[model samples]
Target: MKEQSRRLGEDSIGSLMARLSIPAFIGMFVMGMYNIVDTIFVSYGVGPNGVAALSIAFPVQMILMAMAAMFGIGGASIISRSLGAGEQKTANTVFHQVIWLVIFSSLLIAILTFIFIDPLITMFGAPAEIHQMTKEFLEIILLGAVFQSFGMGMNNIVRSEGNAKTAMLTMIISAVINMILNPIFIMGLDMGVRGSALATLIAQAIGAAWLLFYFLSGKSTLSLKGFGLRIDVKLGLRIIAIGFPSFIMMASGSVVTIAVNWMLQIYGGTMAIAAFGVANRIASFAIMPINGVTQGMQPIVGFNYGSKQFGRVSHSVKLGMLVATILSLIAFAVAEIFPAELARIFSSDPVLIAESEEALRIMLLAAPTIGFQIVCGGLYQALGKARISFIISLMRQIICLVPLLLILPNFFGLSGVWYAFPIADFLAFSVCVVILSTTWRKVFRETEMVR
Candidate 1:
C-alpha cells in the first residue's frame, strides 16, 4: 500500500495515467454495462413498460449514488491528500468515518424510500400502468441501500490509497455478477422487473463484502482501527464539504432526470419516455470513459497538490482534458452516425428504435464539447475546491439543463426535450471554460506564492 501510494507521486504522468486509468476505465466501463445489461434484459423480457419502469426508477438510484459519492469522493480526496502530506492517521480516520457515514446514510435513504415509494414513483412520471412494477423494483433495490452505498463509496477510498486495481476489481466483480444473474432472474425464472432489481442488489452486496474484507485484511493504507464508527464533527464536516460538489453533480442529475421524465410523459407518453430511457443509457455508456479518466486523474491531482507538485498537477489535468475530449468526440460521432443501430441494441420495437434514434441524435449534438466541462469540474473537486466544482456541476445539470428542459419543450414540443440536452451542454461547456481559466490562474498563482 505504501509503495502504491508513493508511485502516485513519483511515476511519469502518462504512464501513471495509463496504469491507473485503464483499470479504472475497465471498471467504470463495466459498471456502466450494468445498466445497459439490465435495460437489454428487461426490455426483452418485460417489454417497453419494463424499460419505462427502470427509467422512472433511475432518479432514485441516482440519489442513492449521489449520497455514496459524497462520502466516497469526499473521503477519497481527503485521504489521498493526507497520504501525500504524510498524515497517515488523518487518512485512516477519514476512511473509518466514511464507512459509518455510508451505513447511516444508506439506512436513512432506505427507510425514506420505503415510506415514500408511491409519491417517489409518481413524481418520476411513472404512468399508472407501470407504477406497480416501478415501485416493486425500487423497493427491492432500496432494501440493499447499505450495500450499494458502502460498495460504491468505498471503491473511491480504495483507489485513494493507491489500490486502483482493487477498486477496479470491485466494480468489475459486481458488474459481472449482475450480468450473469440478470438473465437468470429476469428471463429464466420469469421474475421480470423485480428480478433485474434483485440481481443488482445481490451484486452490490458481494462488492460491499469484497471491500470490507480488504480493509479488514490490513492491506490498505487506511484501516477501520482506532476510530471505528466514531465521528469527529470537524472531520465529518470537512468530508461533506469536500464531497458536496459530487453530491450536487449526481443529485442534480436525478432532478434533471425526473424533470425530463415528467416532460416526456406530458408530451410524448410511454413511447417517448421509453425512447428517452434508451438514449439516456447510450449517453451514459459513452460517458463512462470520461468518468474513468476523471477518476484516474483525481488521486493523481489530489496527491500532487497536497505534496505541492504544481507542475505535475497541471500536466495531469491537461492530459486528462485532452483524452476526455477525444473520447467525447468519438461518442458524438458514433451517436450521430449510428443512432438507430445503437438504439436497436436495447429494443426491437420499430417505434422504440426510431424515436430513440432521433432522441439520441438531437440530445448528443453538442456532446463533443462535454469532455472539457466534465474534466474541468473534476479538477476542482480533486483540488478540494468544492464551491467551484459544485457550481460547474450545477450549471450543466440543474441551472442550464432543467430550465432548457422546461422552456424548450414548451416551444418545440417533444423535440424540444431533445434540444434541451445539447443547448445545456454547449452553454455549460462555455461557462466551464471561463471558470476553469480563472481558477487555473488562481491555483497556479497560489502555488508560486507557496514556493
Candidate 2:
C-alpha cells in the first residue's frame, strides 16, 4: 500500500494516467449508466410522467451529491497533499474527520429534505400534473440520502490514497446492484417510481458499507482510527473551504436544472420537461468519462504540487485535458448522429422522442470545448485554489448559462433554451484558456528561479 501510494509522486505522467484513469472512467461510466438504466426501466414501467417526476427529483439529488463532493473532494485534496508531504498522521486525521462530516451533513440534509419535501419539489419545477409522483420518488430517495452522500465522499478518499481500483469497485458494485434491483422492484413488484428510489438506497448502503469496512480494517494508509468523531475546528474549516468550490459547482447544477425546468414548464409544459430530462441524462453520461479523467489527474496533481514538482503537475494537466477533449468530441459525435435513436430508447412516446432529439443535439453542439473548461476547474481544485475553481465552475453553470437561459428564451423561445448551453460552453472555454495559461506561465517562471 505504501509503495503504491508513493508512486503518485514518482510515476510517469502517461503511465499514471492510464493506470488511474481507466478504472475511474469505468466507475464513472457505471455511475452515468445508473440514470440511463433508471430512465429506461421507469419509462417503460411507469410511463412518461414517471420520467418527469425523476427530472424534478434530479436537482435535489444533485444537492445531495454536492454535499458529498464538499467532503469527499475537499478532504481528498488534503489527504493527497499530506501523503505527498509524507505526513500520514495528518492524512489520517482528515479521513476520519471527512467521515464524520459526511455523516452529519447528510443526515441534516435528509431531515431538511423530508421536512420541505412538498415545497422543495414544487420549487424544483415539478409541474402540477406530475407533482405527486415527484414527491413520492423524492420521499424514498431522501430516506437513503445519507448513504449516497457518505459512499460518494468516501470513494474520493479511497482514490486519494492511491487505490483507484478499489474506488472504482465501490461504484461498480453499487451500480450493478441497482440495475438488477430496479427492474424487480419497479416492474415485477409494482412499486413504480418509489421502487427506483428504494433500489438506489439499497445499492448506496452496500457501497457505503464496503468503504467503511475498507478504512476500518487497517488496509488503508489512512484508517478510521487515532481520531475521534469530534472535528478539529481549524482542520474542519480548511476542508470546507477547499471543498466549497465543489459544493457550488454541484449546487449550480441544481440551480440550473431548476431554472430550466421552470422555463420548460412555462413554455413547453410537462412533455418538454420530460424531453429535457432525457437530454440531461445523455449529457451527464457524456461528461462522466471526462470527469473521471480529471479525477484520475487530481491525486497526481495535488501530490506533485505539494511535493513542488511543477513540471510533473504541468504535464499531468495537459495530458488530462487532451484525453478529456478527445472523449468530449466522441460524445459530441454520438449526440449529433444518434439523437433521435437515443431518445427513443428512453421512451416510446413520439412527441418526447422528437423533442429530446433536437434538445440533445443543440445542447451538445459545443461539447468539443467543454473538456478544457472542466479540466481547468479540476486543475484549480487539485492545486487548492478553491476560489478560482469556484469561479470557473460558477461561470459555466450560473454566471454564463443562467443569464443566457433567461434572455435567449425571451427572444427565441424553446430554441433559445437549446442554444444557451453551447453559448455558455464557448464563453467558459475562453475563460479557462486565459486563466490556465497565465497561471501556468507564472508557475514555470517560479520553478525556473528556484532551480
Candidate 3:
C-alpha cells in the first residue's frame, strides 16, 4: 500500500469528524473570502455600475462552479467509495481521468464564453450603457475558467483522500493571494473591474498549480499515478451521473439570478437590482460557511454509507443539519437587525442601503432553514442517490423558490420580493424531508454493503 493511506479503521468517529470538519469549515470560508472581498470593493468602487456589472457577471461565474461540481462531486463520490472499500488504486485511476477532463472542459467553456460573451450579458438584462463595463469584467474573469475548474475539481479529490487539512491550506493560499492582489491592481494600479478579474485569474491559476503539485509529487494521500491519462467514456459517465445533481442545483443559481434581476428592474429599477445584488452577496457570504459544514459531512456520510455503518451515517447527517441551522440563524439575526449596516459595508447610498437591508433581512430570515434542506439533500448525495438529491434541488430552486421570488414581489413590492426566501425554504424543507425519509428507508435501511 502507498504510505499515505489511512490506517485501517484507526480513528474514533468524534476524532475523525473533528479532524476533518475544522479544516473543511475553514477552507470553505477562505474559499469565498476573495470573492466576497472583491465584491465589496466593486460594489463601492465604481458605485452601482461596478456592482451591477458584477451581478450580471455572477451567473457566468456560477456556471464555472457547476462545471467543477460536475466532475468534483462525481469524482469525489467515487473516490470516497473506493477508499471506504480499501481500493486506492481504483481511486487513483478515477482521479487521473477527472484531471484531464477538467482541462479539456474548462478550455471549451472559455472559448465558448469568449465568442458569446456580449450577447449573453445582454440576455441577462445589462442595459446598453453598462454593456462595455460588463463585457470587460466578463472577458477578464472568463480567462480563469480553466484554472478555476482544475483547482475546484482537484480540491474535492484532496479532501476525499482524507487530506482535508491540505485542501483547506490550498484554499487559504489562493485566497490570501487574491486578497493581496485585488487592492493592488484595483486601487493601487487603478484597474477597476479589469483589475478584479486579473487578480482572480492569477490566483486561480496558482491554486490549480498547487493541486497539480500535490498529486505529482507523490505527496497526496490519494494519487492518480497510473490512471486517467486518457478519458474513459464509462468512467466519465459515472462521474457525471453522480455529479449531475450538483450541476442542476448550481445551474438553478443562474435561473434565480435572471428572474430576480428582471423583476427588480421592473418593480424598482436599477436600485432594486443593486439591492438584490447586495442581498445575494451577503447571503452567499454567510452560506459559504454553511457549505463548509456540509462538505465536512459529505465524506463521513459517504464512508459510513459505503461501509454500511448506517448509524454513523445518520449521526453525521443530523450533526451537519444542526450546525448549519445554528449558523444560519445567527446570520439571519445579524442581517435582520442591521440590514442597513450590512448594506453600508458595500455601498454608501442611503436608498440602496435601505432597500438592501429590507431585502437582506427578508432573504435571510428563512435562510437558517436552508441548513436542513441542504444537509438532508446532501445525505442523499453522499449515498449516491443523485436523482433524489436532484429532484429536491430542482423543486426547491425552480418549482417553489423561483415562483415565490417572482410572484411575491409583485404584491408587496420590494419587501414582498425579499420575503420570498423563507417562504420557499419552508416549502422546500417539507419536500426534502419526504425525499430523505424515502431514500433512508429504501436504500440505507434495506441494503448491506458488499464485502
Candidate 4:
C-alpha cells in the first residue's frame, strides 16, 4: 500500500483531521476571501450596480462550478476507496476520466453560455440597470471556464490521495494572485467589473497549470504513465451517479438564487439584490471552514469505510460534526454582533450597507444549526451513499427553502425572502438528526460483529 493510503487508515483521527483540515480550511478561506475581495473592489470601483451585476452573474458561475463538483467529487470518492482497497489501476483510470470529463463539459457549457449570454442574463433576473454589465462580466469569465473547471476538479483528486498541503497550496497561490491583480485591473486600469472577471480568469488559469504540472511531474500517487485515457462506460456511470447529488445541490442552489433574485426584484428592487449579493458572500465565507472540515473528513471516512474500519469511520464522523458545530456557532455570533460592520467591508453606501446588515442577520438566523445540516449531507456523500445524500441535499434548498421563498413574500414582503433561509436551515437540521439517529447503530453494528 502507498504511504498516504496507509496513513489515512491508521492515523489518529484527531491529529489526522487537524493535519488534513487545517490546510483545507486555510485554502478554502483564502479562496473565498478572493471572492470577497473581488466584490469589495467592484463595489468601490463601479458602485452598487457593479456588485449587483456580480450577484446576477453568480448563478451561471454556480452552474459551471456544479459541473466541476460533479466530476471532481464523484471521482475523488472512487479514487479514495480504490486506493484503500488496493486498486491503484482503478484510481488512475478515474483520474484520467475526470480530466477529460471536466474539459469536455466545461467547454460545452462555455460555448453554450456565450451563444445565449443575453437571454441567460435576463433569465437570471438581471434588472435593466445592471444587465449589460452582468453580460460583460460573464463573457470574460466564460473564457476561462475550462481553467476553473480543471483546477477545481483536480484539486479534489489531490486531496483524495492525501496530499492536502498540495491542494491547499494550489488555492492559496490562486487566491494570492487574484487579490494582487484585482485592484490593479479594476482600479488602476479603470476596467470596472470586466476587470474583476479578467483577474479571476488569469488566476484560475494559473491554478490549472499548477495542477497539471503536479500530475505530469509524477508527484501524484495516481500515475499517468501506464493508464489508458479511455473512459470506462460503467465506471463513468458510477462516477456520475455518485456525484449527481453534489451536482443537484449546486444546480439547485443556482435555481434558488434565480428564484430569490426574482423575488427581490418584485419586492425590493436593485439595491435589495445588491444587499443579498453582499450578504450571501459573507454567509458563504463564514461557512467555508465547515466545508473545509467536510472535505478533510471525506477521504478518511472513505478510506476507513473501504477497509472496514467502522470504528474509525464513526469516530471521524462524530469528531467532524462536533468541530463543525463549534465553527458554525462562531459564525452565528459574528453575524449577530457585526452585521453592519461585515456589510461595510463591501460597500460604503448607507442604503446598501443598511440593507445588507438586515439581510445578513435575518438570512443567517438559523446559523447555529447550519453546521450540522451541512456535515450530515457531506457524511452521506463520503460514504458513497448517493441516494441518501441526494435526499439530504434536496431537503434544504428544494424541499424547504424554495417553498418558503415562493409563499413567504406574499404575506411578509421582502423580509419573507430573508426569513426563508433560517427556516429551511432549522428544518433540514431536524431531518438530519432523525436520519442520523435511526441509521447510526445499524451502520456500526458490523464493527461489533467483526470484533
lDDT of 1: 0.91
Q: Residues 1-451, candidate 3, lDDT per residue (tens digit)?
A: 3432353134555666667778978987876666678877777667777877788788888888888887897888888778777777788788887788788888888899899988898888776667798899989888889999888888887777667887898898889898899888888888888988998899998988888888889887675555635778999988888888888888899888877777776687777777788878888878887877777778777766666677777677777888888988888788778788878888888888888888887788777678787787666777788788788778777898799988887788767767777788788888887776655767744585321
Candidate 4 regions off by >4 Å?
227-229, 445-451
User: Candidate 2: where are CA atoms >4 Å away?
Assistant: 444-451
For candidate 3, what is the lDDT? Answer: 0.79
lDDT of each: 0.91, 0.90, 0.79, 0.91
Residues forming the 10-long window of minimal summed lDDT in candidate 1 = 442-451
Where is model 1 more than 4 Å wrong at Cα? 449-451
lDDT of 2 by residue, 302-333 (tens): 99887888878888988999999999999999
lDDT of 2 at 343: 95
Q: What ranking of all candidate models by lDDT puts the best one first?
A: 1, 4, 2, 3
The top-ranked prediction according to TM-score is 1
Backbone clash total for model 4 is: 0
lDDT tens per residue, model 1, 274-360: 998999999999999998899999999999999988888989999999999999999999999999999999999999999999999
Task: Give all TM-scores, in the order shown.
Answer: 0.98, 0.98, 0.95, 0.98
